[model samples]
Structures are given as structure tokens and as C-alpha cells.
Target: MPTDDLGGRGERIAAAYLTHQGLRVLDRNWRCRDGEVDIVAREGSALVFCEVKTRRATGFGHPVEAVTPAKQRRLRVLAQRWLAAHDEHAPDLRFDVVGVLVRQSGPAEVTHLRGAFT
Candidate 1:
């Protein structure tokens, strides 16, 4: 599959997993002048901002390792933008990451890191 297709598949899998884990997804692929937020959801009283990364193999690194510090900073700004654009508010805010490993064969493996960053 192409890179975009792989990413889309990972996002779909991540969203499904989040739903199964009992989160109420509010947004997906939210974009602004700055950048895009992969997923946003509500888990109880906290609002979650998520980044999803997918890989066919670990040749480079683990998928979660893709969320670099610079990316985290950008995500924080995007979260603020997202909140400002919406009326929704939460008692807590969190940054979460969902990493999907899709091998050439077998089922895809998913790893969710809640509160992965401040």
C-alpha cells in the first residue's frame, strides 16, 4: 500500500480501537493553518488529543518513536487551536499516541500510549 493509504488504515484502526476502549471520538484529521491533529476524543472528564503513527516494519524505529519533541510542541499548539474553535472544554487535557504496526501478513498490532505527553 502507499504511504497515505497506510496512514489512513492506521487511523481507522486507531479510531476503532479507541471506540472499543470506551472513548467518544469528537474529531479526526482536524486541520488548521498550522497542521493536522490525527484524532481528538473524550475519555470521561478529560479531552484527549491523539497522534497516530503506522509502520509496516520497524526498519527505522517503533511507530510511537515518530512523535518527536517538535511534533509534541506542534500538537500542543494545534490542541489550543482546536479548543478555541470549539465550545467544548474539559477539566483535564491529555496527549495520547496510537501506534499501529501492520505487517505484510498477520493481524495488525496496536499500541496506545495514554498521557504520553503533557
Candidate 2:
């Protein structure tokens, strides 16, 4: 599969996983001139912004490691844009990273890191 397709599949899996974990998915693939946010969700009174990274193997490094400081900064800006474009509010804000590793056998491995950055 193409990298984009793999990433899309990972995003779908991550969304379902978050829903299963009781987070209401408010948005997916939300975009702006700045960038795109993979997922936006609500958990209790907190608003969550999530980034999903998918890889077929670990040779490049853990998928979560792909979320560098620069990416986090962009996500913060994107979050602000998302908030400005909508009326949703929350007492708390969180940034999460969902790393998906596709395997040739069995199910894909998912690792979720909550509050991954400030």
C-alpha cells in the first residue's frame, strides 16, 4: 500500500480506538493553511488534539518519535485555528500522539501517548 493509504488506515484505527476509550471524536483530517490535524476529540471536559503516525517497521525509529518539537508547535497553532473556527470550549487542552505500526501478520500495533507535549 502507499504511504498515504497506510497513514489513512492508521488514522481510522486510531479514531476507533479513541472512541472505544470513551473519547468523543469531534474531527478528523481537519486542515488549514498552516497544516492538518489528524484527530480532534473530547474527553470529559478536556479537548484533545491528536497526531497519528504510521509505519510498517521500526527501522526508521518509533513512530511517536516522528512527532518532533516543530510538529508539536505546528499542532498548537493548528489547535488555535481549529478553536477559532469553532465554538467548542474545554477547561483543559491536551496533545496526544497515536503511533501505529503495521505488521505483515496479525493486527497492527497501536501506541497512544497522551499529553505528549505541552
Candidate 3:
């Protein structure tokens, strides 16, 4: 499959994984002027802005490692904008990272790291 296809598949898996973890998914692939958040879910009163990173291999490192400081800043900015537009009652917000490791065989492994960074 093409790389983008694999990425899309990974994102789907990550979303399902988060939902299974008891998060109410408010949005997926949410984009704003600053950036995009792969998954937006509510964990109790806190709104979570999630970044999904997937890789077939982790030779470099885990997928979450790819979320640089600049990326976190962008996510935070976008999350604020997202809340301003749709949420009537802006709740406490946090950032998360869903790391997906996809293999050719066997089931994929998804790791959800809450409050990964600022």
C-alpha cells in the first residue's frame, strides 16, 4: 500500500483504540489555521487534543517521538481555536499522543499517552 494509505489506516486504528479506552470522540482530522489534530475527545471535563503518529517500524524511535516541540505549540494553538468555534462551554484542555505500530502480520499495537506535553 502507499504510504498515505498506511497512514490513513493507522489513524483509523488509533481512533478506534482511543474510543475503546473510553474517550468520547468529538472530532477526527480536525483542522484550523494553526494546524490539525488527529483526534479530539473528551475525557470527563477535559478536552483532549490528540496527535496520531504511526509507523510500520521504529528504527528511529517510537512514533510519539516525532511530535516535536513546534508541533505541540501548533496543536495547542489549533485546539484553542477549535474550542472557540464549537464548544459553548470551553472545558479544561490537554494534549495527547496516540502512537500506532502497524505490522504486516498480527494485530497492530496502539499506545495512548495522555498529557504528552504542553
Candidate 4:
């Protein structure tokens, strides 16, 4: 699959999984001047900002491993900007990672790591 196709599929899987877990989706592919969030949802009283990483194999590494500290920092900044744009009021928030691994001969798998980092 093309890179974009793979990314879209991963995001779709992540959204579905979150919904199945009882989270209400607020947005998909939310962007601002700062950065973009792959999936946004409300889990009970908290708002979730999710980053999705997809891989065809682990030759490089697990998909979640790609969300480095720098990436986390960026996510934080983006989330802050997102909140600012909505209102000065901040909601309970958390960062999450959704790892989607697809294999040509096997079923795809999704791993959701909530509060993976601050």
C-alpha cells in the first residue's frame, strides 16, 4: 500500500478502536499553525490527543517507538495550541499512541497506549 493509504488505514483503525472503547471522537487530522493531531477524542472527562504510527514490519522497530521525546514535545505544544484555539479553558487531557502493524500474510494489529507519556 502507498504511504498515504497506510497512514489513512492506521488512523481509521485507531479511531474505530477508540470508539469501541467508548471514547467519543471529536476530530480527525486536526491541524493548526503549530502542528497536527492524528485523532482527537473525549474519554470520559478527559480529552485525548492521539498520535498514530503504522508499520508493515518491525525491521525498523515497533511503531510506537517512533514517538520520541522530541515528538512528544511537539505533541504537547500542538495540544496546547489546540486548546488555545478552542478557548482559554483547558480540559482534562492525555496523550496517547496508537500503533498499527500490518503484515502481508497476517491480520493487522492495533495497540493503544494511553498516557504513554506526560
**CA-lDDT, candidates in order:** 0.98, 0.97, 0.86, 0.90
lDDT digits (tens) for residues 1-118 of candidate 1:
9999999999999999999999999999999999999999999999999999999999999999999999999999999999999999999999999999999899999999999999
Please give the lDDT score for candidate 3.
0.86
* Worst window of 10 by summed lDDT in candidate 3: 83-92
- Candidate 4 clashing pairs, residues 3+ apart or interchain: none
Give the distance in Å from residue 114's predicted Cα in candidate 4 to where it truly belongs: 0.9
The residue pairs that clash in candidate 2, if any, are: none
What is the clash tally of candidate 2?
0
- Residue 83 CA displacement from its true place in model 1, Å: 0.1
Clash list (residue pairs), candidate 3 = none
| CA-only RMSD, every prediction | 0.5, 0.5, 1.2, 1.6
lDDT (10s digit) by residue, model 2, range 1-118: 9998999999999999999999999999999999999999999999999999999999999999999999999999999999999999999999999999999889999999999999
- Which TM-score value belongs to model 3? 0.93
lDDT of 3 by residue, 20-90 (tens): 88988899887776777788888888888899999998998999899999888888788878878894353
Give one digit per residue, the lDDT tens place, for model 4 in 8-48. Answer: 98899889999999998888998988789998888878988
Cα deviation at 103, candidate 2, in Å, is 0.7
Choose 1 or 4, whichever is better by TM-score: 1
| Segments in model 1 whose C-alpha atoms lie over 4 Å from true places | none
